[model samples]
Structure formats: structure tokens, C-alpha cells
Target: MELGSDLNAGEITIAQYLKDVGYQTGMSGKWHIGKEPKAAGFDFSVFFKSNGTYYGRQINDEGIVRKVEEHCDLYCAERSVDFIKEAVKKEAPFFLFHNTQLPHMNGDLIWDARKETKERYEVSEMPVAANRLDDLSGKPEYLKSVRNLSQAKVYGYPDEQAIQKHTRDYYAVITEMDEYLGLLFQTIEDLGLKENTYVFFMSDNGWMLGEHGFTSKVLPYRPSTRVPLFVIGPNLKPLDLDQMVVNIDIAPTILEMAGVLLPDNLHGKSLLPLLKQETVNWRSSFVYEGLGTYGGALPNLTVINKDFRYIETFENGTLEKVIFQEFYDQNNDALEVNNLMGSAAVKSKVGEAQKLINAHKNRILKQ
Candidate 1:
């Protein structure tokens, strides 16, 4: 039922999948995927919207909009924690999907938290990204004029000061989120649900704090593409994994965890093997995609591997036609400051990247 070439456009979600197998599903915070949580089979939902304000937040609860007083993220967390505690009392297993707005800087971009938490970190203390000073020479021209809510204050200032302030606030907001997560985790611990519950933490996307002089996501850059993923549950060893992963795998992983039969058309592989410390042959790389922004920016796709990232940026004017290609040697240039596209030195690796992209396109367009 996934119509597009993008496999991330899922028809059956993890919630729907789990619901079929008998699990109590609940969700809070942003549901950006167009459909409401009920449509996707969640029994209980809250505060779900595409994006908006923090305080005086308008949250949709079973089709009713309730104006909330506290910050949106904290309010959602408190409700989610309460749901977790109450849900376990029932006979069914529960899956509480807790999403927070603390880290999200979209739309008028509320950079807010508790007063003490926001001021806890000094601006100088937060370490800026290595590519924070990127001049945008290799980037598209239209991106320069994107003065929307996410980037107005971020790109309006002088370079270093902008990066410092953005990074400082980012950390500040994350610190507040950490406090909320601590509360949620403690609830799980106290309720004796740690052994049975699997808490998977990840974001839809990562932001660029002046990386390549950009303030928002939607670029093929690592700063925008790479996100922190944490999977915690009983009998799972805690260790760093260098394997390539993506958000697509989340649904399939959940189904696998719940002992459901995997549909053959799934575009993602489960991480259960990896979590059990078993040796499994996993994907060497994957594609990063960004659809054009309301005729403003161009649609771009990148073939990303451990050692290299190759991009094919399409024309904004024509949309379908390729305008330019970029290749980064991620080994030597981890910050992605250098573009080796069409360079004679990396032609062989570039060829491999092209093949990868072609194969991925074929896989995506199977419908």
C-alpha cells in the first residue's frame, strides 16, 4: 500500500502491527506522517500535531483540541508517564510512544525549557560542529534564501556567534528533555516494567546548528542525517554499535520484537540479531532523501556509506533533472567540508556510489 518510491511512506505502522498481535498502543507528541494515531491503530493518543507553539499548546486528544499551559514536551511526558503506570494494570501488554518537543526548533522555533535548566550551560561551553563555519560554496543557491521560522534567528547573525548561541540553546533544551526522560525511565523502573518493556529512543531528523551555515534539517549532510539511536531493554548488552541504521528499521524491529510475521515487502531489517550480539551481515550503506520544500529548495538524494557520501542534487527549476553531484570522503574529511565530486582521484569510489544509488532507486520504485 506504500504508493511512493520512498519506503519510509509506510502503510502499516508498528502500532498497527502490534495492535494486530494484542498490545495496548498509546502515543503522545508530534505525528508528522499525515494520518492521525487512531487511523494507524493506536488505542490511546494525545497532544498530536504536525508542529507548532510550545506554551499555550493546542493538542489534539481524540479529535478534541485542548489548550495546555506548560511546555508541550514536558506536558506530553507527564501524560505519557501516567499512561505507562495505568496501562500496566490492564491485562494487555502496552506500548507507550512518548515523543517530546524539547529538541525540535521548527516554526517560530521555541527554544524554551525551565529557567534554571536553560541557563545551566554557558554558550562558550557547548562545542560547535567542526563544519559550523561552512561557507555554503558546495551547497545549492536556493538554500541561502530559506528564511523560514527554523532558521531566521539562526542564519541572521554573524557566523561564530550564531553557531555558539544555537548550540548553547540546543544543549539547554536537550538537558531539559533529559530531565523528562529521567522521570519516565524512573516510572518504568518503579513499576517493574523494565524487564518487559523495550524503550527505543530516536528522532525523525537531526538539526544543523550552522553546519554548512544551515539551521534546519532536509539537507543530505551528516549533521542533518545522522541521529542518536538508543535501544534499551532486558537481556540486551549495552555497547556502541558502528553498524549503519535508519528510522525505517524501527517498524520491522518492533514487529520482530513482538514475534510477528514479517511481510516480504518490508524495506528494513530487524536489529534483534545485532542486539543479541549475534554475527549478522547487515547493510553496508543506505540512501538519505529530502523532498523539495514548496518549490523553494531542490529535491536531493545521497548514497551514504561508512567511508563515503555521494549526493545527486536535482534541479529546482526542472525537479526531475540532475544538476550537480557531490562526493565526500568521510574517512579523511569526516566533517564533509571537501566535495570530491567528478574529481579524478575518487572516480572509482564515485562509480561504486552511483551503482548503489541506481540499485536503491530500483528497489524503491518496485510498485
Candidate 2:
């Protein structure tokens, strides 16, 4: 139930709906769905107090701090397993959003991996992923700040070795999570409810893996918005939705799957038909936004269609003039190494995208 990309307020927090619908909702791992999990309707949560860290996790049991410990993911998985077992005994359907913070960075696991990988890349040598903003040192009032590890000096800058080590460690965590997901699947099967239960596995946002000379998950780049989303359940037919699907659509899709009527106010349309391998008459483009300037305020907007993507960054203080524009033709430069925003033909596409963005924004705000 990593409902929407932004773990922030008012962005289709599905956990709230899960709890409201009488589903025993339990969250293990990052509960970045605003400052209060209990208020958001999570029954039990083992969340991190802050971002970037694995050793010594903070737990909140319905709003109260319960405990903290190292090896957070392992503990979280144990608790989740227990919750599942209990839910089975109670004869109730359970919704567990196991959002892992592990591949996120600044954790004991990272430190361990650094040592394990024998410092392959210098800390400074590695650059942020393309989707993240760089150089936040000047703006004190910025929403977020991006900082490379202090240990970068050891890597002799260009931290290739460090980056490689981090990548390996991140994959290791994913492997561990995959194993847990496998267990979860097994548990569902063992309980004879595999056919009925719906499970979605996806990343909240795409991570910067040394793409575009930047790192992090804030930029309006493809790596950030293009998260991997997959579903395993009874109703959903296996099919890849190659066309653009925004994060906002997820809420309606889940609601539709559970036989719940989608709210008319939601900005997204139900993706149930698409999941069933049915042709859906939907929009060709998706609108995207992320943490604003500083780290969270530098307003960025994007329109991604099946064939092309256009992104615009507004000046920090003034949201009027476009500071930068990037255009990528998926058919031609699939890697997105080249920018076509400057071309005359590309400008026409951007012009169209602007109208699409305006329409989406108006529709959502009106709702």
C-alpha cells in the first residue's frame, strides 16, 4: 500500500482508507505519511523517526513510542509475520504496508556494506542520481537539503567505489525484502487465501542510481517518477501497462479492487480495466510534482506521455518564469541522455504539454 509517491500529507494516503474500511492496517518500516501515523489511522506501526538510517529504529504503537532497535527490517518482518498470523486467527482480512527504508541510505546496513564491499567507491566520488537537486548549501530556508556522506574524502572524490558498494548493499536489501515478500505470499497460500488477497509491490519513488550526474528522488526526471509497480492477485490479469500511469491512479485502482466505490473527488480514474488487460480509454500524459524548493520547494512540473516527456523547473521564489526545460523522446533517446527541449519541434510538444498540465491541475484542484 505504498499508495502514492510523495509520503507527504494529502497525497492519497491509502493506509487511512484501509483502516477506515475495517481492515486491520499495519505498517512496518517507513511511515512517512506525515508526522502522525495513528492520526492517519494506522493501527500499529514500526516507523523511523527520521529519514536515512537502519540502526536503531523508532516504533510507534498507535501514537506512542514503543521501542527502538538495530536490524530494523528484520524486526519489522518478524512483527509483520506475527500480525499476519494473528489476523488469520481472527478471521479478518489484513492490510500490511511493509514500506522498507532500507535502500534509502545512512543506515547501519550501509555502513556494513561499505566495509563488506571494501570501499569500492570513494564517498565523494559518487554523484547524486539525476532526479535529485544538487547544491542546497546556499538556501537555508529550503524545504530539503541534499548532502553526500562526510566520508567522501576517503574515496578520493568521484566516489565510484563508494557508489558501487552502495548499489550492492541496496540490492542486498531488496533481495532480503523480496524474500520477505515471498514468505508473505507463501503465508497467504498456506492460509488458503491467495486467490482472494491482493498484494502490490512497488517503490514509492524511483531512486537516482548515478544517472544524470545527480542523486536522490526529488527531480522531475524519469528515474524518479518511473517507479516499478506490480500486482499479484485474483482480479488483476498479468499485463504491462507501458503507457503512462501516474501515482494518483493507484488509489482508485486499489479501491476498485476491494469493491469500494471510488470517491468522485479523486483526481485519478480507476485502473481496474487496465489491470484486467482491457483497453482503457485514459489520458496519454501524466502530471508529476515532488518535494519543493531548497530540497522541497524548487517547484517542478512534468508531463509524460507514451512517447515523450517534458519537464519544467520554476525559479525558487518566482513560480512564473521557467528556469529550465527538458524534453526527451522515449522512442529515440530512451536513455534520456539528450535534451530536445531547445528544438523548434520539441517546443510545440512542450506547448501542448503545458495545456495538459493546466487541465490536470485544474481538475484536481476543483475536486
Task: Pick the TM-score winner.
Answer: 1
Report the C-alpha lDDT of model 2 over 1-367, residue by residue, as the tens digit: 2332344456545766766677787877766544566556667676655455555656664456755565566666767777788887888777887766655665432434334343444444434444222333222222233332222323322355545555555565566556556666777788788777888777777865555434457666677678898878885666677766777787788877766667776777877777778766878777786425433437767888778878766677544666666788989866566778668877778889989866755654554
- TM-score, each model? 0.91, 0.79
lDDT of 1 by residue, 1-367 (tens): 2222222455677788888888989998876655677877788888556566777888887578889878788788887887787778886788878788768764676575567875887877766666655666775666667653235354554357666766777788888788878888999889888898899999877877766656667677887789999999989998899999988898788889899999997888999999998999999988876655542557777988899999987876433577888888989998888888768999998888878776766665664
TM match of model 2 to true structure = 0.79
RMSD, each candidate, Å? 3.1, 5.7
In model 1, where do residues sit more than 4 Å from their true spots?
1-10, 146-158, 317-319, 363-367
